[model samples]
Every structure is written in C-alpha cells, then in structure tokens.
Target: MPVIKDTFGYLQDDRRVDRITLSHPRSGFSVEILEYGARIRAINFPHARRGPVNTVLSYASLREYELDTAALGAIIGRCANRTVARAHPEFQLSCNDGPNHLHGGLIGFGRSLWRAVACVDGGSPGVLLELQSPDGDEGYRGNVSVQMEVRLDSPLSFRTVVTATTDRATPLNLTLHPYFNLTGDPDVSIDDHELRLAAATYLPVSQDQIPTGEIRAVDGTPLDFRQRTPIGARIHETDGGYDHYCPLLPGSAVAAELSSRRSGIRLSVSTNQRGIQFYSGNSLAGATPRMFRARVGLCLEPHGFPNALNEPTFPSIMVQPGETYRHDTRYLFAMTQD
Candidate 1:
C-alpha cells in the first residue's frame, strides 16, 4: 500500500482529489483510487493482459462537465435508491414531497468532498475514506457518518465496503456507482454481453422512472435475466432500456454475473443488499463521437429496495442511533472462454 501524489500532473482539484495506489506483489495487480468521491479511477490486472484496465468511465478529461457530479465511481449513500418524495408512510415525514427522492436528492455523496484516511501498514492493505453529513444536509433526517474502504485482494478482485452510523433515526441505503467497460472500448455497447441475475421479480417503474409500489414477475417480461441473454436483445422494447430493480434472494452472496464474449472478461457481483438495480446506461450521451445512443454501458447496483421508506411493504431502511449500518459489495473479475 502506497500513498502517492499525481506524478504526471494528471490530477485536478488537488485539494479534493488525492490518489491512493494499492499493489499486491504476488498477485501482480494494481488499483488507483481518488479521494474526491472515494472513486475507483483504475484497476489493472496483469494476469488478464499486460495493460488491461477497467475504469468507471473517464470523466477526468471532461472540462465542461464535472466528473464528481456524474457520480461515475463514487460511494452513493445516506440513501442509495429512489424515495417517493420525502414522505415516509410510517414515519409521517414528508421531506421532498413531489414524486421521488432519487439518489439522496440529487446532490448526494457523489458531489460532496470526503475526508481521506490512509493506512500503509502491511497488515491493512487498503485505504479508507470517510465523510460526515449533518442532519438535513440533503433534506433528510439524521446526522450520518459514512466510511468507504477500497481493498485489493488480488489483481483480479477489488472489494468495497461501505458502512455508516447515524445519530438520528433515518432511512439509509448505500451503493457504488461504477461505470464498467470490460472491452475497454468506449464506442462499444454492452448489448452483446451475456448477463444472468438471480431475481424472481422486479419493481416496475412509471414514466418518471419511479417505482409503482409493485413487484412484478420477470418471467415473461423484458426484465427477465434468469438465463444468459444478450443485453441488446430486448433493449429496444424497453422505454429507455432496462432500469428496474431486481429483488435478490435472502442472504449474502454473489447475486449476478456479466460476461463479455468478445474479450473473455467476466465480472461477478456479490453483495448483502436485498435488491440489485440493473441500469443499462440509457442516459449516456457522448459529444465527441457524435453518436447519441442508449444502452452504452451497464450498471449492477446492489442496494436496498427503492423508495423503501415510503413503501410499507418494502424492507426497512431506517437505522437507529446505536445500530451501525454495514453493507458490502464486491466486483470479482476473471478471464474465461465461452
């Protein structure tokens, strides 16, 4: 574990964007992290290829558009998924009463500056970033403290552990927003990739992309991913293409698998959350290539139910003062031939 500054002068916003590099001698793997949003900038696996790199889309070079605001590879928290306004049916609190509160009312953890805490001991092979948000910072209750730890187990795997504590009782849901390009080709769409999710049903959304408080079966719908299927196969039938929440089976383990046939790269996602939101990156619009399209990339966000606070039937998102909120999600990368 080494804490180094930007040697090539590539880092902008020096005060907020400190870099943390982790290397495993035996595994031959290296990972680079930025403290701005506690974002994972790069992951290099030597066994897969000499310079094979996995990144959450490069927002670093986009001057007109701020990288932090995009929530590229940041720790999203306080509340991870959507909330139907700020009104909690049980709690009787209407915070942002209109339609829904998506990702902590817009300017969530992605936009805030996190405090970097580094540990270089050989025993602790990773760095932890922490942030504290006062009550009502984003129009929500409870003063919350968030900690995100990035650890490199080997060249092929990186684990992110996010834990939080709140002084006041409030709904808490957290997840990582990482844009992955297994092929490393920005122009390439994830349509050809094969995906399989262990979900029986998914929450349907309305025109505004808000959950309708119904858990519909995915057996005959476009949301089905029980078996391997090409991502683009049924995307055109969907409004903006798959942006629904898939309910995970009870317990903690690997929930889904995404594989790119062309590159023989496989990504396995494991988490403790009860649901996973599969977003196909339908909102991405690139100005450079002059190619405006949907489903450019895919996101498998493991989290609690969307709008759980307002939906009485959904799982509980409330975190009491003394209870510590702990959740873990891991992305394991491997090379295979199909």
Candidate 2:
C-alpha cells in the first residue's frame, strides 16, 4: 500500500487547497502533488549520502506557485509547450509567451486546479489526478478530459502516465515539467551532472524559440548527447542552455540517463514520446522566493514537438474524438558505487 499524507494548505482565490503526498517506503521515494494545477509539489528521493532530499525545485507556499512563471513541477497540458500563432483572427491563440501560446495559455494546467484521488493500480499504489477542460478553453476546441497517474513502483522507480480524450479534434501534448538536480544540495548547480541520450536527431528552433520545421542531425551540433558528457561542456554555446526537442530514435528503449557523483544518485529516463525537450533552466530562479536559480536544475520533458499544431512535417499532435491520447514517462533511480 502507498503511504498518503496531507501536506501544505494553499489558499487560491479563497478556496483552501491542499497538497497530497504519496510515498514508497521500501524505495524511499515520495511524490507530492497539489490539487492546484495537479502539479508536483516535490519529488523526494533517498540520497545515497544525504539521506532523503527533494531532487526537484519547488516552492514552500501556494502563493509562490500562483506566481510561478516557470512551469516548475507541474503536469503541463492542453499542449505541453509553445503553440503557433497565425495572422488570421480565427486561428490566433492566447499570446502568453511573448506572441506564443505557452503551456495552454495564461491559465494553463499548471495554474488550474484538478480533481485528485488516491488509487492503487494492480499491485502498485498511485494517485489519479484529473481535469476537464471545456471547449475553447485555452483557445483549444474540445471538451477534453485529462488524467495523470503517478505511480511508485517499489525500489528506485516511478511512473507517469498521461491520458486524455476529447469530443473534438485538438492539439493535445501533455508532459511533465520537473527541474531535477540529482545532488541533494540545493545550492549546487547541475553543471557537473553526467548525461547521456540515446536520441540522434533533434528539432532546431528559430530565434523565436519555436521549432523551425527542421529535424537536424545531432552528430556535429552541441545537441549531441549520444555519449556521456558533462552538461555544462557546451551549454554556453546554446542560446540559454538547451531548450530544444530531441526526438527519440527508432525502437523501444531507454531515452536518456542522468547521474550525479556528488550524491551517488543516477536517474534513467524512459519514455514513449517522440520528442524530449531538454531545458537547462536558464530562465529559472528569481521567479519565486524558492531556491530556484539558473543552472541549478534541468528539465527533460518527453512529448511531441512544440508548435506542432502549425508544423506539418513534425509529429502529429492532434487528438481526435473517439481516440485516446497517451504518453508515458519513467524515472529509474539507482545509487552509484562509492
């Protein structure tokens, strides 16, 4: 059985909201999620050296999360990343991200409250977070039902499965937004983290930070993560520490791996999504009173490419009626040898 606990009390628009935490005792892994935004409040892992510590950046109060410009530990939905804009009024979306519709516009899933419940799937214990988006909500046409299941599967592994069904065809790309730091210390940066990716091709973004409809080879660019390398080795070369999508190569296999020598913790990421957005958290920190600073944590969001609604050559992100949209991501944690 999963150990469930009531966390902080959040006051949003006079509604008293509460955060819930589900933990696996044997693995020493815990995930805290909030009703507001169905967002992850914190992900606590057993540090090989530092005892139990939260690996993801987060805020202590709901007020800080209310002002969170960065997605933080949230379930980004309606669409995970940025959406395109057309000159025609009929095709225009909310301009929240400086002319783009980011994370489902101004009041996206990250800022909205969700219906949450505790559930046990099979023999594994988890939490089911649900949300119903009305037709035309966030400029999308459809009454969409989104469900996210966060499961703690015993020692050193957790799973996130996001599914949605809509009455109308619409762009539906859902993904996780967790700025992770394997190191238990919040003061230290993730520049020294060792990362390796199985992906070989990546989507190049324009100056506007939107994918340029180009799927380029990673062999010669700084986007290459085929071999294990220090994250900061070429981060300075990117516009602001990698924020582009790396489409997973053919076959069913592990997508990426991240390890930290400081804490002896290793995180292996596996996903079924076509694209993974690697962000170095360049624009993080300073947004909240929390310990959020640039370069401190990194996010690996696996899903469809950003602006896919407008890009034809990119992977299809349309969720039509009678069809189910599903994406699954897993994080396997292990302790490195001393």
- Candidate 2, which segments miss by more than 4 Å at Cα? 87-90, 121-123
Q: In terms of lDDT, which candidate is strongest?
A: 2
Tens-place lDDT per residue, model 2, 263-314, is 8788898898987898888878665557467888898998888888888777
**lDDT of candidate 1 over 1-338, digit per residue (tens):** 33444422223455435567777656656677766566666666554453655534554442322433445666676777666663654443323325566677655776566766765535236778899888877766788998888876655676888889988988888887776767766678889988989898999887777788899999888788888888888888888678889998666367998988777778888998898999887776642132324555667888899878777788898899999998887778888666
Which residue pairs show backbone clashes in model 1?
85-100, 86-95, 86-96
lDDT by candidate, in order shown: 0.72, 0.81
* Prediction 2 TM-score vs. true: 0.94
Backbone collisions counted per model: 3, 2
The deviation in Å at residue 75 for candidate 2 is 0.9
Give the Cα-based TM-score of candidate 1 against the true structure.
0.88
